[model samples]
Target: MSTLLIKNARNIVTMDGERNVYPGGSLYAEGQRIVAIGYDLPYDKADAVIDAGGKIVYPGMINTHHHLYQNLTRNIPFAQQCGLFDWLLTLYEVWRQLRPEDVYVSAAVGIGELLKSGCTTTSDHFYCFPNGVSGELIDEEIRAAQELGIRFYPTRGSMSLGRSGGGLPPDEVCQDERTILTDTRRVIERYHDADRFSMLRIGVAPCSPFSVTTDLLRESAALARSYGVRMHTHLAETEDEERFCIGRFGLRPLDYMEKHGWIGDDVWFAHGIWFDDGEIARLGHHRCGIAHCPTSNMKLSSGTMPLAKMLKAGVRVGLGVDGSASNDDSNMLLETKIAHLVHRLTDGPTAPGAEDFLKIATVGSARVLGWEDAIGSLEPGKAADLFIIDASKLEFAGALFDDAALPVLTGLSQTVDTTIVGGRIVVMDGALVGVDERKLAESAQAAADRLLGEATFRTKIDYRARRNALSM
Candidate 1:
C-alpha cells in the first residue's frame, strides 16, 4: 500500500463540519483516501511528502456543470453578442463539426483551466452529436481527465429534437432518442465507477427543455435511476425559455419538469435563473439540486437566480462555470467570487457571505453532483481532493492581515498553487502536470478553425428559427 503525506507551513482549511482551520497542519493519505488531518501529524514514513510553505489549503473546488466540448468554439465572433437561443443557433453549425479529436483537445484545455482555478472535480455536459460523433466524445473527455488525474463526471448529454422538429438545435446536431439512451447505458456500464475514490462517473442529461421532448427527459431520468447514476439538464435559463414552456407545455419549465419526473435529490439543473417562489419551494421540498452559473447567466443577460431565496428555502445549490464558450473562461474560483458578490448585490444586507460562496464551490457543488460523502472536504476517510493557494499573491496581500477563516479569504483574490485529486497531484505550482499548455491552446484553436469550415454542418443551422421540419 502506497502512502502520501502533505505537510504544511501555513494554514489548512478543512472544510469539514466544524470548518476548522489548522495552522501549520498536516494531512496523511493512504492510497486514494485521506487517513488523517491535523496539526503536526507523524509524516516521516511516506512515499511522497509535499511541504506547502506559506499557503492556504482548502477543499478543491467542485464544478457541477460545464460543456467541455464548447472550448473548441470559444469566442466565435458571430455568436459574441447573442442571447441563449440565438447563440446556440449561431454555434450549432460550428458544434456540428465536432470530432473525437476536437472533444479530446477541448477537454484538455477546459479541464486544465479548471485545475488551475482549483477545481479537482468537474462535470461536463457534452450533448452535440453531428457527423456520427458518439460516446467516444465523452470517452475522450474522460481520457483527458485520467491523464490530468482530476476527478471527472462526464454527463452523456443529448438533444433529441432538432430545429426541424421544433427544437433549438439543428437536425445534424440532435440524435435519435433510442440511440442516445442506449449509448448512455453503454457508457455507464463501461465508465461509471462507484468506488469511494473513483476518478470518473457518468450522468445522463437530455440537453434542455427547448432541445428535448418530455419523453426524453422522463426516460433519461428513469434510465439514470435504473443504473443508479444521476440526472442533469438545463432548466429555467432565460425569459424566452419560460415563455416557450408556457406556450408549448401550458406550464412553466419547473412544472413541465415535474410532469416528466425530473425533480429529485439525484437531479440538478443548470441556470435556475427564472424559477418563481413556488417552483423554488417545490425544488427544496423534493431536494433537487441547482448548478448556479452566475457568470454565464450574467453574460447571457439571463435574469438573476434567487440564490438567497433558494438557500433560505433549503435548496441544494452549487457553483458552475457553465460552458467554456458561454463563460469564455473556465475559472471556478472566479465563479465563486462572482457568485459571492452577485448574491450580495441581489440580496442586499441579508445576503450570503464569502463562506457561503466557498461552500457552494466545494461541498455544496459536491452534494449537487452526488459526491458529498466522498469529496468536498478535508475529512478523514474522504478522497484526498484539495487545493492550496499562495496567500502571498498581490491580489490577496492585504486580506491576510485580518482574515480569520479561509472561506472569508475567498472574497479576496487569489490563484491556486497546487490541486490534488484522489491523492494524486494533477496541478503543481499553478501549471498542469504532464501536459503542454501552449500546445493544448494551439491545438484547440486549430480544431476550432477546421470545425468552422464544415459546409454540411453550416447548412444544417437556422440562425433565428426556433424549429425546423425534422424535429422529432
Candidate 2:
C-alpha cells in the first residue's frame, strides 16, 4: 500500500461539523482514505510527500449536477443567446448528431476542467440519446471518469416523451419507456457501487418534467430505490418549465414531481431556481435537495434562486455548474463565487458568506449525492480527496487571514496547485497527472468541432476501439 504525506500546509480548512482550520498542518493518507490530519501527526514511511508550506488545503469541492456531454457544444452562437427552452431546442438538433466518441471525449474535457478548478468529485446528468447511437453511452462517460481519476456519479438520464408525445425534445432524441428503463437496469447492474469511498455510483435521472412521461419518472425512481441508489433530474429551472408543467400536468413543477414519488432525501434536482417559500419549505421538510446553478440561471436570464429562504428553511441546498452548453464552462470555483455574489445582490450582502458557500460546494454537495460519510470533509477515515492552492500566489495577496472564505470572496478563477482524489494525485503543480492536456485539448476541440459541424468528422470512432485504446 502506498502512503502520501501532505506536510506543512499553510492552512487546512476542514469543512467538518465545526468548520475547523489547521495552521501549519499535515495530512497523511494510505490507500484511499485519510489516516491522520493535524499539526505534526506521527508519520515516518511514505511513498510521496507534498510540501504545501504556503498552500491552503480544502476538501475537494463536490459538484451536485452537470451535463458533461454538452462540453462538445459549448457556446454555440445560436444557443448562447436564448432562454432555457429556446436554448435546448436549438442545441438538441446538434446534440442529436452525437457519436460514442463524442460522449467519451466530451466527458474527459468536462471532468478535466473540473479537476483543474479543484473539484474532486462531480455528478453528471447526461440525458440526451439520439436514434442509432449506441446504448452504452453512460459506460463511455464512466470510462472517461475512471481514466481521469475523478470521483463520478453518472445518472442513467433518459428522455422518453418527445414533441410528438407532447414533450420539448424532438422525437428522434427520445427513447421509449421500456428502452430507457432496461438500459437503466443494465448500467446499474454493470457499474453502480454502493460501498462507502467507492469512486463510481449510478443515479437514475429523467430529463425533466417537460420531456419525460409521468410513468417513466415513477418507474425510474422505483428502480433507483430498489437498487439502493440516488435519483436526479432537471426541475424548476425556469418559468417556462413551470408553465409547461402547469399546462400539461395541471400542477407546478415540484407538485408534479411529488405526485410521481420523486421527493425525499433520495432525490435531488438541478436548477431549482423558481421554487417559492412554500415549495422550499416542503422540500426542506422532506429533506429533498436542490442543486442551485447560479451561473446558468443568470446566463439564461432565469430568475435567481431563493437561496436565503431555502437555507433558512433548512433545505438541503448544494452547488452545480449545470452544463457546459449553458454555463459555457465547468469551473466550480467560478460557480461558487457567482453563487455568493448573486445571492448578495438579490438577498443581501450578508446572505451566504464565503464559509457557507464553501460548505455548500463541499459537504452540502456530498450530502446531495449521498456521499457525505466518505468524501466531503478533510478528516481521518474520510477519503483523501482535496485540492491545494498556494495562498502566497499573487491573486490571494492580502487575503490569507480567512482561508475558508478566500476562494469565494476574492474569486480564484484559475487552476489550483494540486488536486488529489481517493488518496491519489490526479493533478500536480497546476497540471493534470497521467494526461496530456495539450493532446486532450486538441482531440476534444477536434471532436467538438465535428459534433457542431465546424470540423468535418473524417474519422469515425468505434466505441470498442476507443475502449481498447483506453485499456492500453
The prediction achieving the highest lDDT against the true structure is: 2
Report per-prediction Cα RMSD to one decimal.
3.7, 6.1
Measured against the true structure, the TM-scores of the candidates, in listed sequence, are 0.94, 0.95
Model 2 lDDT, residue 220, Cα? 93
lDDT tens digits by residue: candidate 2, 123-195: 9998989899898898889999999999999998999999998998999899999999999999999988888
Worst 10 residues of 2 by lDDT: 463-472
lDDT of 2 at 308: 79
Q: In candidate 1, what residue range of length 10 has the lowest lDDT sum?
A: 463-472
Model 1 earns a TM-score of 0.94
What is candidate 2's CA lDDT for residue 401?
80
Please estimate how well model 2 matches the true structure, expressed as its whole-model Cα lDDT.
Answer: 0.87
What is candidate 2's TM-score against the reference?
0.95
